[model samples]
Target: MASAAITLAAEAPKLSSANTGFMLIASALVLIMTPGLAFFYGGMVRVKSTLNMLMMSFISMGIVTILWVLYGFSLAFGTNNSLIGWDSDWFGLRKIGLTELWPGYTIPIFVFMIFQMMFAIITPALISGALADRVKFSAWALFVALWLTVVYVPIAHWVWGADGWAFKLGVIDFAGGTAVHINAGAGALGVILVIGKRVGFKKDPMRPHSLPLVMLGAGLLWFGWFGFNAGSWLGNDDGVGALMFVNTQVATAAAMLAWLAYEKIRHGAFTTLGAASGAVAGLVAITPSGGAVSPIGAIAVGAIAGVACAAAVGLKYKFGFDDSLDVVGVHMVGGIIGSLLIGFFATGKGQSTATGVFYGDHSFTQLWKQCAGVGAVLAYSLIASAVLAFLLDKTIGMRVTEDEEISGIDQAEHAETAYDFSGAGGGVVGTAVSALAGAESKKVDA
Candidate 1:
């Protein structure tokens, strides 16, 4: 009877239907963030370059998806070595069965693959904000392909892969503080250095063309982030998932308020742009710390990140580097804040048995590990991205011609415009009605 029972227990499947469903839903939610990013970046640029901005993000979704299926996933997640993963047998997911569990998880291997793919898609898109309105579409696309192969896949392996050095070194990145945000932020700075600034950067009034659109994008990004932060647990039954979900909300709200407070104190008035940027800063800061920090700790992380990123954005102007949309400020700086603070705020009971300096551990061991992860990823991404951008600039040209940039990237590159101000609706009466109604003109130089 004992032998029969043991055999039956061994025969039971490891897969859990409920967890699989949850992961499927989470993957879809995360997929929506790329389009949300398109809108977020599109509205932040001038109207004349809106389509170009949108395309820069949208194209990444397509490019990264294909790369993930072909070799990106295998290289990042497969088991080959400590620094990088070899294709082995999982190239193109070949021979991997759908029912096969992802190592120790309840979800199917395919489900895990798709979830990680969405992350790969958005990381490079984040860099488009820095090079907005100035890059050639083809060159940008090529850079995405090369950068993913060289920079992203290797960094992902180092941080998340089981045999990777960082993972073995006790570094704690619940989601992607170092792997995604810091990597992309550093890459953005590198690319902008090689590509140079926009034609009339400091001399021009480059305000956002549509604050409403930016708000809409920010809302979608916030909503999708619930899936991003919570789903990293790879299971729905874990109580930590709930904690992470709440932490995400608390931190984002706190960060938005802190940003406004800082802006009010420094600039004399709260701005819509500050609110949207603050929300994003909070999201980025809490991502890696959410599963480890308490709600109160999340507030501290968010507020610190908000103020730091807000101040960091201005440094570009002082230093003469034009990070058009402050990707370096919010993502890189926010990622560092979240990663390092975990050493001080981590509860030592959840996620991992690691406590921060503020949590009474006093050792500062975990904090040093976080610093190592952040510094390694930041340096690798910066150097690799700079090389890629320089090679592209020399061979195929990274920037648009001066005439094309000044005239408008949308028409010069894509031959399309985001808005039409031809007044084909009703001519003079429509114009007069719009004016009487206080409707802003589409032709206005936003």
Candidate 2:
């Protein structure tokens, strides 16, 4: 009877329908973030470049999805060679058994693949904010392909793969402060250096065209982020997923308040843009630490990141690099701050056991490990992204013509505009009566 029972237990399916259902919902939530990003970036640009900004993000969704299916999943999560991964079975997401589970986890291999696919989709979309209003749509798309192949995939393996160096070294990235945010931020810096700034960058106002849209995007991103952060655990068998969810909310709230405070003191008002950007800054910072830190630590992480990112955004003007939308300031800096804080704030409680400077035996072991992972990803992504951008710039040309820059990127590149201006001599709404009069005087317009 004992032998028969052992055999039956061994043969029972490892798949967890509960976990699978959780991941599917999580994947759908993460997918919405790209459109949220589109609205966020879309609202930041002038009306002239609105569609171009949005398409830059939307194109990444299209491009990365194809690449992930073809070779991205295999190369990123397959058998690790320390620096990268490969497995022909996962090539084109093929040949795995219908019920095959992902090694140690109860979820099916396909569920894991799709969840990670959402990550690949948004990482490139994040970089588009840095290049807004200037880049050719085709060049940006091609660069997304190249950058994914070279930079994002490898870093993801390094930070998350079972046998990768960072993972083996005990680097504790609960989600993706290193793999996603830092990688995207450094990559943005590289491309901007190669492509240069938007025309009349510092001279032009370039304020976000629609704060309401930015707020909507921020709301969507915040909503989607629960899946992005909590779902990283891949299952709710343990209670870590709940902890991560709470931390995400805590840190994000602290960050929003901290940012508003900073701007109120420095810029003399609490700006909506500051609130939105701050919340995201908190999200980016806590992403790596949420699974490990207590909620109090989460507040510290969020507040620090919010204030730091707010200050860092102004550094572009002081240093004279056009990050268009402060990708480097918020993402890069926020990721770094969150990662390094792990060295000090880690309590050795949850998903990761490595305690930080403030906890454990007070040793810096985990801190050093975090530093190694952060530096490696940041340096590699920056250098490789710059090379890709340079090659694309030299070959197909990255920026639209100067005429396009002044005329409007939407019409120049996409041949479409965000709003209609065909009121025939109305110009820009002289008055309610004048607008009606002009419409009546002119032929009907589309």
Candidate 3:
């Protein structure tokens, strides 16, 4: 009996191959989301600015990856203090061995690093949508580098880090509601205020050039989000990952339908753009709460986010802010809804142990905590991003010249065009028509 007891105690220390494989695949899935975001945002812009939109997202993948490898991972995941981490021993991953697991988790420390790296890459990419078609490429690149270091690194430490104040206060951000979506959303709003409106703003029509591409991008985002939401569990020991997976799907579907339904009632036309936007809204709302809410709860969250975000998008026009691609409306508003709803809908059975008011916890404590997380991140991102944009604007300038604005940004900035209007000099038909015209002119002259 004594020997059997000792063996059972030792078994828990062994690495889990199954969990490792799942996380490896999950990391790959999440990595693809950045390009998917590229396509999604790329298709939403006018054709003249398409490539710039795509590059903005793709560049974040490169920039954040290097930053994460150097010290970002350490600052985010290291244990040091309540507000932000300060351990440099794991810098460049020198201290962590490949064979060693992450603390008590089944996966290697490297696997966890790459998985989190994907999240860090996509967060700044999300902000690109709001600043499309206006800012200089160099300034934008610099902003990405600066924003990630000042705003993202610390907020991520606060929300997801081991000793983060939010984490210690019982706030439940299962994935990245406060850290990623809210942070990016508020950051976008701040920069938009500093940069001012796009030249056309509401005066000219800036319709999406390709609906098909938008749909394709949205499809990819939906597919990859499974890994993003479910894989946050870090392991599959208790089947909670499966629950998160189902919740993600159900919520997305519900939100898409809700958006379409609202469009039909208000606009009299159900648009493909509306559908794609609705799906993303649902995904954003469920991201933080998927592990805590039931499928029914997910449906409610999706429906609410779909309607709220759909309505919120129009606020740019009403309130007069140039959120070029609805990032403020969809991501910021949806993230807030998801984070706060946890106070009302949390079941306290899956990933988080805290129950909501509806679940019979009978207190507003969780709601207050959620508010703190959302408020702090939003306020900090807004002020910090504004200062960064203002400084860059005053020093190096942010916008292109007026002539560049009238001409397409592709030609003005990159010296290339997404579409070439120049045709072949002349085809066989053109040659025949020219010869006949010359014969007629000669006959008339004679």
Ranking by lDDT: 1, 2, 3
Worst 10 residues of 1 by lDDT: 437-446
The all-Cα superposition gives candidate 3 an RMSD in Å to the true structure of 6.0
lDDT of 3 by residue, 1-446 (tens): 99999998787655689998999999998999899999999899987788888889988998999989998988888899987786677798888876778877888988999999999999999999998888888888888988988989899999988899999888899899999999999999999999999987899889998889999999999999999999999988898899899999999999999999999999999999999999999999999999999999999999999999999999999999999999999999999999999998899887878888899878788888999999999999999999999999999998887667656677677887665433323788667666765674465345
Residue lDDT tens for model 2, 1-446: 99999998898758899999999999999999999999988998887789998898898888999999899998888885988999998888779887899988889998999899999999999999999888998999899999999999999998888878898888888889999999999999999998998888889788888999999999999999999999999999879999999999999999999999999999999999999999999999999999888999999999999999999999999988999988999999999988888888888888867788888746688889889989998999999999999999999999998878877889889898786545344445546556664564362221
lDDT of 2 at 144: 92
> In candidate 2, where is summed lDDT lowest over 10 consecutive residues?
437-446
For candidate 3, what is the TM-score? 0.93
> Where is model 3 poorest over a 10-residue stretch in terms of lDDT?
417-426
Clashes, model 3: 0
Q: What Cα-based lDDT does every candidate model obtain?
A: 0.91, 0.90, 0.90
Give the runs in model 3 whose Cα sits over 4 Å from its true position: 1-12, 423-446
| Residue pairs with backbone atoms closer than 3 Å in model 3 (clashes) | none
Error of 3 at 346 (Å): 0.5
lDDT, candidate 2, equals 0.90
